[model samples]
Target: MKRVLTTLSAALLVIACENSKGPELTGDKPPETAGDTSEGDSETGPDPDDPPVVTSAGPTTEGETDTGTTGDTTCSFVCDTTGGTGPDIQCDNWGQDCPDGQKCAAYANDGGFSWNALKCVPADAAGGEVGDPCTVEGNGVSGIDSCAFGSMCWAVDPESGQGVCVALCTGSPEAAQCAPAGTTCVVANEGVLNLCLPQCDPLLQNCESGDLCLPNPLDQSAFVCILDASGESGTTFDPCEYGNACDAGFVCQDPIFASECDPGAKGCCLPYCDLSDPECPGANQDCLAWFEAGMAPPGYENVGYCGIPQG
Candidate 1:
């Protein structure tokens, strides 16, 4: 809605300028010279010969977004009947414990972008099923999207509210799962974005759209594609917490797994290497199996990490 209004405002300005011009000097008077700055109207104010002012009360459509500045509160609600403040309508994201036509979804209520609240919303919006293009009702945090039953819109553009439907992780959070074999469930944003993300090869790092391939958080056996949140400083031995926090060819490892890592650090970035030709950066270190015996997915059996191998 903001986008539309801004566009409309621009168009209106163009039309007004075109209308305000001195009627092209059609009848008798010759057209003014190019540098003629005759004091008809100053650049700072409206034109004297401009047409009647045009105004729009609001959007013609019933549902339009109110997304403002980025720092403005993203914490919006779908059921804020109690004057935009009330107890959250929590529900099971896995079970989707809502009425027959509704689905449970996570959202935010605090000032930040994290999904710290839940709500049940009607599922009769727009796009349904996974991978479909969709839109959000209010802002992105409204928890009311155009996806049906078991999916929620992901990768939403905050201003436009446009996104794609992604399947919510099924089963319990502890034992979360996805449908397709190659896709892994990704639980993120304080568990609001529980969707199936595609798996990738740590060696090849063949993720779509520059996403990083890292070890699956559910299990370290295989790699999964995730959005890279590790900005410029993602180099070797960089202290990190999340697996994707490391740049490409590196994965987050505990101090025990990362040789010479800061003794008190929680985790650090380490390189992945081919098991067939083992290599390590530190002295006496060896590329060890990242996953347990016989656990790596097919074609990725040779994936290993540089670490101090135990005898």
Candidate 2:
């Protein structure tokens, strides 16, 4: 399938600008510089205590080392595939500095620009394998722990501080490389990274006993296997701990629309519907706009959930 670059939301745009100095894994922001002090300089020469002006060599040129310095402070740009930067060292431009069998890949921080800084990573390494506990630490500034060559680590439940590493695959089911036999590659994020998940026909409601096949919020064409929420006894609405914690046929919606929910409190599990044939099983329930318009492939305006109609 064609790879579609993920769109940057307003929050992500702000992060991109804030992290323009380096890769998103390091989460490093540009340091604040002191105000100019030209008033104290003599007409004949320079000040004895003032810091020296430092200039960048501009964007790095091919095969040339780039350096930045201020006063006695000096930093050199270096490329190391292993990870991390040291005193006077910065990451190298992946395109220009990476060795053979390696490619420069950008993580997280995304905006109009290509990438702020490049990391030399194995051309085929995703960082971790499937079922591994995936996480990124150190504010994402220096380096990051990523999945293996053909996988991505996604948060399974924010509240539980749990995540799973899943293999990345094309939209074609035949190309899926999921383990344990029958799982298929589902379009977790259409045009972006597809994930290998257990297969089930939602219409038939025949899942692996305790699981339910539900349409994904990002892609209706694909379904995900989640714990059945139908057995939970509650009113029409109830708070949830995880995105899939609600009773069967309901999805836990976060109060804040984020790529990952905050720990402890996800939102309420609500019934979702197909806009093409909207339906609600309870009184005063109506299909309301869930995801915003144009957030995904079919457009956010076309996606909705069954809920109480607001006045």
Which portions of model 2 show Cα errors greater than 4 Å?
Answer: 1-106, 110-127, 137-143, 156-162, 171-182, 188-190, 200-213, 216-222, 225-248, 251-280, 283-311
**Tens-digit lDDT track of model 2 for 1-311:** 11111111000000111122211100000101101112342211111111111011112221111111211222211113124421222233321245675533333332222123335455435456776866433222222435555454443232332345555443232233445354544321101223455654433445543454444322333445543322243123565422333444554443232223332442444555666678866556666544334433333344455655433
Name the weakest run of 10 consecutive residues (lDDT summed) in model 1: 1-10
Error of 2 at 214 (Å): 2.9
Clashing pairs in 1: none
| Residues 1-311 of candidate 1: C-alpha lDDT, one tens digit per residue | 00000000000100000111100000000001101133441222111111111111112322111111111223221112212232354776766767888888766555323343567888874457787878776555557888977887655643455766777788864677898667876543323345576778878889765566664434445456654434464467776534444677876555555556775654566788899998777656677765445665678778877766443
Most TM-score-accurate candidate: 1
How many clashes does each candidate structure show, in the order listed?
Answer: 0, 22
**Candidate 2: residue 172 Cα off by (Å):** 6.4
Alpha-carbon error at 27 in model 2, in Å?
Answer: 27
